[model samples]
Target: MAQKPLVLILGPAGHTGDSIVEGLLESGNYRVAGLVRPSSLTKPSTEKLRQRGVEIRAGDLKDSMADLKKHLEGVDIVVSCILAMVVLDQKDLIRAAKEVGVKRFIPCDWATPGQRGIRPMGDMKGEIRDFIVDIGLPHTFIDVGWWMQLFLPLPARSKREPEVHARVNTEYAGGTTPTALTDLRTIGRWVARIIADPRTLNHPVLICEDERTQKDAFEIGCRLSGEAESLAAKRISISAEEIESRFIKFKAASEASENPMAWEILYPYWTMAYVKSIYVMGENSIASAKKIGYLDAQALYPDMTRTTLESFAEWFYALEEPAYAHF
Candidate 1:
């Protein structure tokens, strides 16, 4: 296609939402639309999408099939970026889109596709994907890693300097499995490219930039900050016991659906391991624009890119604009 597909990104108003909108608009090829409830529309992020010519549709997954059908009209692509904790009842939008004959769909699976069969989120995506196929709808799961946006504001202990940023090392899948993190800029950029290409439809696409551990992060951070590494840093690992404990903690806190500190604390263990569910994508690969070369997108995308964890910290620091305050 000469131009990218027209897309409607549902729940494009949170941290990742703003970046995705910018990526689409900058391409000068894709027509953008954003799906938001009245609340998201009032948020500052909505204005960013609006300025990019994204039509803000005032509706949500809570809407019935008819209401969803009304909003999805003439939509070639429907991306679910909804911030739903559990998607048990959230399959309404997918069903409605299929009924409306939408060409392509991107599920709100910001996690890794390797997680599809293993993690709770993976099961959720699997259920949705299965139903979509049974009903014969074309879809793609834009499975990305833990977003790079989360690592910023860097532990509040650092030296300010122009040459370097604070270093951040993370290991989500215990210390053995690689922790693949994507820059929000890359996710937004990748989403735009996926919409532009039709070949990616009906396939699962995973994008993660680099892998690094806590030890590596500290080493890099010290170099950037112009200081020798702190000898006190300890390595942390995500074990089954840790994951189980976290699940218990979160479940207890979320009894009334009151998500608080416990939920965030426990999620890294259970959520990451479970979501790291392995599915077929040519032997668990990481893909990115920098490695594959953005122009020749037809080939199999690279599993990982050259962007390291330490360097990503620098990029986030540089984009010190108001709209994307800290991610």
Candidate 2:
């Protein structure tokens, strides 16, 4: 009998990482391992992964190249699902992967697909990607269009009452542009298949289960949650120029402010930039992704079950309060 490939994942306890870990474990095809911070070793989420038989290693992305290489030694594949704030830090990890000659290195690109300059976060991820390509690291880039978790309207008990649901008001330039949406739970399934497939080597893949305009998604949520009136009232629209203007303003503020918490102000606008790219620039759809040389995940895996927006909304509304709020 052949030995299973060893797959090491960074950020296995995170929202997206957790899903990916679950998918890999469910597939039962590889030896799963995670590199978690030493401080988080005792956390429930980390413990859960340990209980599931995952080989947990204590290390940080900011660790020295020698240390990272040690952690990556003998790993066949490395999948990074780390947070966006620290995406640029992946350079060291990439160097380590290259040094160790891992079979595959999957970067942390679990968001909408777009070119550089369209989104700040995208640019950060792009920097790591450029470094990977420049150094000739065998890799795959995966982007799941906007999360379905953020597609629905906030559930409300009554129109006259205050909003109690955890949903936030999403401001975008347009509502008619079609944007791809993917359930967070299903991302890992797509990733699992992509990593295992030889065709995805050194290619970018877009994982989109459902595509709908913002208006259409809200209507679906309204229909499912019985909060048409309330949801409709919460729709906030902004012009493209306004989005760009605010992005500039907040970005300047974030750069100029001396306070350490300056990111708090710029974070929303950074997110707004992403929203503008998807809803107004139309960069989140499969068409856009393909235009930029991304492999269509749906076409690649026809056997995989997709969680549609309507179905996700139905399941989302039924919950008293969803524990996983990506928005």
Candidate 3:
């Protein structure tokens, strides 16, 4: 309940990590501690964090507690948002958070699909969460919903328009609806508010804007394409069973070690969490997804207005970010 501590965010230089830090810093709600690898000190985001006056500490995530404790000295919370495909060593960081006196720690989990549908994600994040709780470390599992920008139409390299090409044929669990998706751009700031509020505690808060849904994506995409006649422009209905089946198939393909399909493993969930959640229940379920215990980000930041998928899509390609230079 007390204001968030001079929080330390492990891996604060990465995409999701930087967004979280920016939100916290910009809110003027908490000071940020940036834990990054010595090699990454020169990273664009790390340099930017330093310029913004965040306490940036360089350390190896794989190092022993003695090596990482320095960064944790005065830290209240740890927010980690590393890319999984590239980074493998998070246990040391988790152990260090426990060994040190960090009050609450937020994990890198960004996909906030419905509770029932995210079983696979939990399977991925389960051990880390349990380990933290077992060590008596207060941990917050923040599931930011799907990254909608990745949805839209597929690239020229990939022929099928996601709208036209059906990646997952499964419908919703109840066999009455198709899975829904959310705009992930809305997630970063929601995470900031969650970490800022004491009531969020150390719980899994599924972060999504109030208007999050698969329909949002369909409507917006249709509008953007100027294809009112396109089926995606109009609301379509499928069963929950179909959605669940599609997700399960998608997950099985993702878990396939023999030939891991990259997009199947990562982007589908990012594109469908909201749709899954919508089928499971509805907008009311977003609170349970975020694990507010009894609070919501909107209530916490009364002045906050979440960006809709349509607005985010327009701005997504417009950001003049230095990290990514489109050739």
Candidate 4:
């Protein structure tokens, strides 16, 4: 029998990474494998993926190229699911893939490109893209829009007054500005199809289940949570200037803190960056590239189901109660 195409998922233990694995498995067209850190061996999700017949390879980002080359031995495609801090580390992995002659490389950039005043995250992704192209590696950048999950309040933080679900907030979330908000399942489905389709190679595929403003999503959430739209909790609207100010403040605090790596400082830094990207800057950010131009790949793949905010709210609340209880 001819061997099936092998896809090695680097950083498969993450929520997005794991979703990619499930999507690929559902398709059953590619031989799936995952590259996990050595420390993640004990994770339940890691073991679950292994039991699902995924080939498991353990290696560190710090591993030498020659040492990491073994993991790419038979990998036909490499999809990286690594996060922010470890993003630049993919350079080493890319070098190893080139050394092993992998066919296609997918970097772990699920979000759209960054814009002016955004953090080094977008800049780093751009550098990665350029490096991949310069090395002559055929690649596909899957630019899925903002995750609907982030818009909803998670279980752990539900105890506090949930702001995202609020109908009125200064975050500039809900307005006429159409932002592509997507659900994880939809992201998984699109990514799997993109990986299998040869045409998607060397191009960026933009995806968004729904293009609506923050207010639209908030209204859907209010209905889902059984909240009174008229009596919805709200905050003073945040502005772009305020967001930029907070970004500088948070970044300065993060650098000045006794433990710069502390979560207290890091959380604010992340939150500020996020608010700046989605709320303050909106389409002015890097993700605006797809928002402004490019033919959405969803048109190319008509069969892929798009999830609306109402549908996402239903699915989201089904998993957990509407977190508006605190309000």
Candidate 5:
């Protein structure tokens, strides 16, 4: 009998990392390990991962390359799901992965896919990819257009005030541009398959289960949740010019502010920029992904069940509380 390949994930307890871990475990084809910060070793989340039979190691992305290479020893694959703020820190992980001869390295790029100027975080992710290519690391870049968790409208029975739901239901840049949507939980399933396949080696893969314009998603939510009139009435529309203007205004504010906590100003800029990229720029669709040289996961894995926006809305509205509360 052959031994299972050992896969080590950098942020095993995070929203994205946890989902990826779940998918890998469910597949039952690999041995899973996690590299956690020394301080997080005792957290309940980390303990839960341990209980589930994941080998946990104490390390950080910012650790010295020697220490990271030591931690990565014996690992066949490395998948990073680190937070956006520290994405560039993956340079050390890339170097360490190369040093240890890891079979594959999956960077933390689980968001909308676009070129350098499309989104700030996308640019940072691009920087990491450039470094990976420059150093000749065996790698795969995966981008899920946007989490269905973020795309859907809030359920009518959500605990938050109706105004909050209204804010989430706003339409940006005419809301007619189509964008791919993937359930956050399903990303790992696609990733598990991608990493194990030889064809995805050193390639970019796009995981998109469904594609719809903003208005389409809103209509589905309104129809499914029986809030057609109320939700329709609350919808707000912002033009592309307005979105661009606001993005520039907030971008300048974020760059000029000297306060250490200036992320508060930058957060709004990110939101607006994302809107511009997805809607105004129309860079989040499968067509755009293919244009940018991404292998389509839907075509690659036709056997896997695809989750549609309608199905997600059915499940979401039936919940006692909203499953994802980004609004």
Candidate 6:
């Protein structure tokens, strides 16, 4: 038999990264190697991958250039699932992949179809996408759409006040704008399919579990979580223009603060930027994807069953505490 293509995954311990790892391993089609940072070696997910017979190589993305290049040796494909904040660090990674003659480079562009200019950090990801193209390596960008996990809400109370904490409150004030969303399980399968297909090379592909307005998603979550009746009167309602204005103000405050590094200012700026990008004009997400000849997840993998918002909400609320529970 001919040699199987060797696929190397970066940041394999992360949310999306781990999903991709599980999918690829389950497929049993290629020799999979996961490049994890030293800090991630102790993680339970990393240990699980190690036990699964995945060739685990430890190296840092922020540092370790020569080591990263060394690990890329004989690797036919490189799939990146790095976080948004550290996306720029892929510049060196692209150079290394090109130097090692890696066949295809898949960068972490997994979000709404049009992430460029939507947020400052998104612009940074766009820069990395452009750099990948400029480096002369065959590449593919996967736009996985909004994550379903973000819609789940949990009730909380301070000493003085009780409130519901959900990203939908901030991101989708006027929640009834068409939004494309995908669950992590679907993204994992879609990514594995992309890795197996040669036609996906050198383009952006949009994949989602389904498309529904943000309000639809919130309603699904509320109904499943049993908070629908009580939360009906507490829905947040804000206009798109107001969201834009808030984003601008937050950006200004982040820049003007004496300690811009402080979490107080930086957190709001980041949150506002992300909210503005997704919900301010979310109807455009699918439109932009189609303008670029977008490939749908169902069309790409017909045999694969897609997750629905309601089903996701049911599963999410069933958990003792959802994955990545944030205050």
Each prediction's TM-score against the native?
0.72, 0.92, 0.70, 0.85, 0.95, 0.89
2 versus 6: better TM-score goes to: 2
Q: Candidate 4: which stretches are off by over 4 Å?
A: 153-157, 160-170, 229-231, 234-236, 251-262, 284-287, 291-295, 321-327
Over 1-327, each residue of candidate 6 has an lDDT whose tens digit, in order, gives 888888888888778887887888777777888998887788888889888878998787766678779889889999898877688888887888898889899887776765455576667778888898887889988888778776555422212123325344433656766777788765777787887787788877888777887667666666777777555655567778888888889899987899875778877787778776667756336676777567665677788888888888777777776644243
Off by over 4 Å in 6: 62-65, 155-166, 169-173, 257-262, 323-327
**Tens-digit lDDT track for model 5 on 1-327?**
978999999899988899999999999999999999999999999999999999999998888888989999899999999988899988988998998899999999998888787577888899999999999999999989888887877765677876667667889988899999998878889888999999999999999999999899998988888888877777889999999999889878877888523678767878787888899999999999899899999999999999999998888788787645354
Question: Regarding TM-score, does 1 or 5 come out ahead?
Answer: 5
For residue 23, give model 2's deviation from the true position in Å. Answer: 0.4
Candidate 1 local Cα displacement, residue 289, angstroms: 17
lDDT of 2 by residue, 1-327 (tens): 987888999999988998999889888888899999999999999899999989999999999989999999789999998987789888988888998899999999999998788687888888888999999999999999988887766766423223324234454676678889999988888888999999999999999999988778777877888878876777777778887787777767766778624568757658667866887788999999999999999999999999888889888888777434643
For residue 73, what is the lDDT in candidate 4? 86
305: Cα error in model 2, Å? 1.2
Q: Choose the strongest candidate by TM-score.
A: 5
Query: Comparing 2 and 3 by lDDT, which wins?
Result: 2
Better candidate by TM-score, 3 or 4: 4
Tell me the whole-model lDDT of each prediction, alpha carbons only: 0.60, 0.84, 0.60, 0.73, 0.88, 0.75
lDDT of 3 by residue, 1-327 (tens): 775568777667666777777778777878788877888888787778888888888887777778777767888878887766433367777777787777888876765434443554444566666677787778777665445554443222333344443432223343333322345434556777787667778766655554444545555545654444643433345676666666676666666745554664666653354455555555334445445343345556677786666676565434443113111
Model 5 residue 176 distance off true place after TM-score fit, in angstroms? 1.1
Query: Residues 1-327, candidate 1, lDDT per residue (tens digit)?
Result: 455567888777765666677777776777788888876678877787677688888987889899999999878888777774645555788888888999987777776444333455566767877777778888876766656555433432434331123212333344343445677766777777776566677766666666544445555544553334442242334554555565556545544454433555446534434433321122123433233222222234453244567787666445433124331
**Sorted by TM-score, highest first, which candidate order results?**
5, 2, 6, 4, 1, 3
Name the runs in model 5 displaced over 4 angstroms: 161-164, 259-261, 323-327
**Candidate 6 versus the native: TM-score?**
0.89
Candidate 4 yields a Cα-based lDDT of: 0.73
- Report how far off residue 22 is in candidate 2 (Å): 0.4
Best of the candidates, lDDT: 5
Model 1 — TM-score against the truth? 0.72
